[model samples]
Target chain A: MDGWLVDLVAKYNYWIYVVLMMIGFYAMIRKNNLVKKLIGMNIFQTAIILFFISTGAKKGGRIPIVDYEQALAGAVQAADIVNPLPHVLMLTAIVVSVSVTGVALATMLKIYKEYGSIDEDQILERVKNHEP
Target chain B: MNHNLPILVLTFPLLAAFAVNLLGKISKKHVAPWTLASLVLSSVASFFVLIDVLENGTFKYTVGGWLPPYGIELVLDPLSALMLVLVSWVALIATFSALPSIKKEMPGREHLFFSLYLILICGMMGLVITGDAFNLYVLLEITSITTYGLIAMGRGRAPLSSFNYIIMGTVGACFYLLGVGYLYLITGTLNMGDIARLLPPLYESPTVATAFCFLMVGLWIKMAFFPLHGWLPNAYTHAPAGASVLIAPLMTKVTVYLMIRIIFSVFSPQYAFLIHGRVQTLIVWAAVIAIVAASLIALSQRDLVKMLTYVVIAEVAYMVGGVWLGNTNGLTGAVFHIVNDALMTLCFFLVSSAILYRFGSTHFKDLHQLFRKMPITLCVLVVGALSVVGVPPTCGFFSKWYLLLGGIEAGHYGFVGALIFSSLVNAVIFFRVLEIAFSSAGEESVPAEISGSRETHPLMIPSLVVVAIALVVIGINAGSFLSQVIRVAVPSL
Candidate 1:
């Protein structure tokens, strides 16, 4: 029980990310609605960003920003601070996520305008029928 | 003197994309000329950079004066320089050929159209040269967003196709991001060169292997290599002539270049290929299946533009197979095919747009008497078609020869067979189009037949003619191109 608990604690965050990622992937591949697919895409991107953030996290570590005196005194070791690189990377990913969602929404509007519906099957049906 | 050419090649299009937008809001008529002039300028810039890369070898430019491992850097290697020239040249040709269709289809959206077009070019340029993994992802999104915008502006089901593309493209990009996240977790660096240097020790780790899988799978989806190509045909078929002409030629080819970059540059070939014989064989077989299946499906398409998209799928398979051949010949052929495929696809799309412009129809049936009506256009189409069918002294033939040689050298006879089968399939598709267009002369004097005036814009045919001649020129001069550029490029890889 102790070993199991330690293993779970050590790897639980990645497991959570994997679960979220699978859910997103399922919705993206299997959902019938266009908006649901977009949501899945967002969830998918967010899960990845979360995974990166989690990687950068360190227990009992301070923020990446360090005090000048602490640094000058050689009191602050690099490992004592959370790695800031993944956090910075996730910031860019977040921006990309937002932009992608925005473009997707705009395209969904156009799709809705053309088909009068966003349901995947109905849109495919109408498109097959060559309906205006 | 030429140290700035790398940044300049990328910035020219980005600045012009914005400039065209702002400048057009003030004066709509000036937009087209300005866009063309800037393309010319960028093409000149690209040529200069390619020359610089050749003379100076691969050089890295530090963005904003921040050195590598800490900040974004752009590396101008032989592969990126070749792609730089190809993208700018195709964009230049496509822009000129696009005038007729853009005027006919979107009318008032010309500014938006050209701006997004330039943004796509800029994004692809940035994608090819950037050395940082995260920066490549950002540039990829920029390219995808602009591509979605440009694709959505087409008529009919285009918006829906664009929506589908957005979902798939985003998922592909996200998968790539996940791979980067994994890499960052293990290596704590985002610079590709830095990560590469730090990766050899971790090559045996499951984390690194999984990350490689994620990266390749993401890129495979993006390139639409067979099974994942559901979004491509509808998007290309329903697209307005101009957009299809540009997007069809460049998008998949750019993604293939990205795959090569990831394999040779980021992961390093020794680790990517030499470490795993089974994995290489598996990918090579998958590519062979993609080639044969996509070609057969392409042969069944009635719409010319849509058929070409499937052909693009097959071409993607060819490159993927060639690259995975795990030998110098295979890799070099794959790289050389990149340029050859781009130019030929552009020529094909250009001719299709000219025909579409003349007939205002996308159906193969509407091409009746096309040979008699537009002899010049028909001739150009014949050249493009023959090249695609791998007729000798046409550009596609040389690439296929190299690919076949590579396949045999790698002992992947299945891949060689698939290449030959697809070439036969190309013959069927193009020759069928030729028969449909030429077999029946206009017995009833159709209005479009024998116009002799060329209803398509005059500028469009010149572009088509140039591309057609270029196909032959490139094929004939493949020796020089291979020896000077690709040979040097592959050895460095």
Candidate 2:
């Protein structure tokens, strides 16, 4: 039991992300407010971003940049440098998440203007009532 | 210049999108022609790329002279080459009708509309050709964001539908990104080819299997396969006619293409089929339910375009089931159906737009005297309807034939039954509409607003005629298309 607990704790980052993702997914499905849904979406995406960034971490490894002399001589060991690719990839993902939030907020504004409510149930009720 | 065809196919539209926006600020009249010219150039380049790919076979073009497994690469095979041509040409043809439809629908925002439209096309073209897994996610988001913006531009519940799509689409894309991150962590590479090469040794790992599940679920959501298809009907139905004409045909089809890419290119067929036979069978059954359920729901719709949206969902199931059948004939049918369904869906949406252009609604009641008022448009629509019904001498029949053959080969009679059942249901759905339009009772029940024959914009008819003719031409030459293009595109089983 102690060994299993250590194994589970060793991968605590993945468990944190999984818990965060499920929370966001639950809010996205269960929340009535459109803005809350958007917020849930952001949290969901942020968890993924964190997951990606965590993938690049290494124990006792410095940043990815190497000394000029070490790079030219091919003497730098890969194990000593943290992976940079996932961070770079996450940079793009952050931009995507921000753009998605922007679009979602814009769409929410339109929904508010059109239906006079941002609650999903109210908006659905209005739609059902044919009240423009 | 010849070697640059792959990247050039992407750059033309990406550059034109900004140019169109700038030109639109100057004058709205410049937007249509400028967009068309750029797409035409892109189409020609794509055609040449297809020729080159057919001649040389699959080749990768590393971006900015950087080598692969590191820098971004554009992989061009017969499959992607065919998709490139399909996307560019379909956008070109759809634009012909879309310009006039936009003029009637949105009126003054043509420039803004075209800008997003061009960007969406660029994103799809990029999705087809990019070999980098992470790059594909960026392109997918590009495509989704543009679609959300375009759909929100419509009036009356469109914003709500667009909001729903944003939530769903973001989740789908983020899931895909997470899957790619998993792949990168396990394989230490983001290039699809690199991951495929590294995957076989790690196939038994739980992490790889989990990544595969994430990828499939993500793509399934994007493609509107059965259970995850809640966003499609509302989003597509409420979108502006002009935008729907462009999006209704391409978005889901491209996602389906991505699903195929992940299955065959990023992971070998053996891994997807032989090793995971149970999952494959489950997905096939799921697809069967999707087809039957979507077709049944389509029967309940009163709006013409909404009904067609349900039909689109059903067709997506057809492709998903075909590929999951795990046979060459099945994959062939799925790929060929993607081409056919895109054209036919474009046809159906174009006809709806034309109908909406004249009558201001696509409700069945509003369709009275439609056959008389818009004879040419109705004729084209009938051709499209027949194609959807899988009748002979149209492109839809040949692909359905292949899918049926594939289903039988796989001995999944449930899938085969679902196909036949859906076809019959489609025939019923379309013929009911035709009967309403053709019957004199409709004219008698509602007073005729116009005295004589009326059609969509003269320019629109040419494109409609072209698409209708292309459908027949494709059907007649389905044999050649299969042999020359699809056969080559199918990866060895």
DockQ of each: 0.87, 0.94
lDDT of 2 by residue, B1-493 (tens): 3778888888888888999899889888888778998999999999988988888889788899999988999999899989999999999988988888788788878989999999999999999999999999999999999999999999998999999999999989988988888888899898999899999999998889889999999998998998899999999988988899999999999999999999999999999998888999999999999999999999999989999999999999999999999998899999999999999999999898887777678888778667887899989989999998899899999999999999999999999999999999999999999987886653344532432345767778988899999999999999998899989987778
Model 2 CA deviation exceeding 4 Å by range: B441-453
lDDT of 1 by residue, B15-124 (tens): 88888888877877867887888788889999888887888788889999999999899988877888889999999999998866797677777888888888888898
- True lDDT of residue B313, candidate 1: 90
Candidate 2's DockQ is 0.94
* Top candidate (DockQ): 2
lDDT of 2 at B380: 96
Chain A TM-score vs. truth, each candidate: 0.91, 0.94
Residue B322 of model 2, lDDT score: 96
**How does candidate 2 score on lDDT?**
0.91
Please identify model 1 stretches exceeding 4 Å from their true place.
Answer: A1-6, B441-455, B491-493
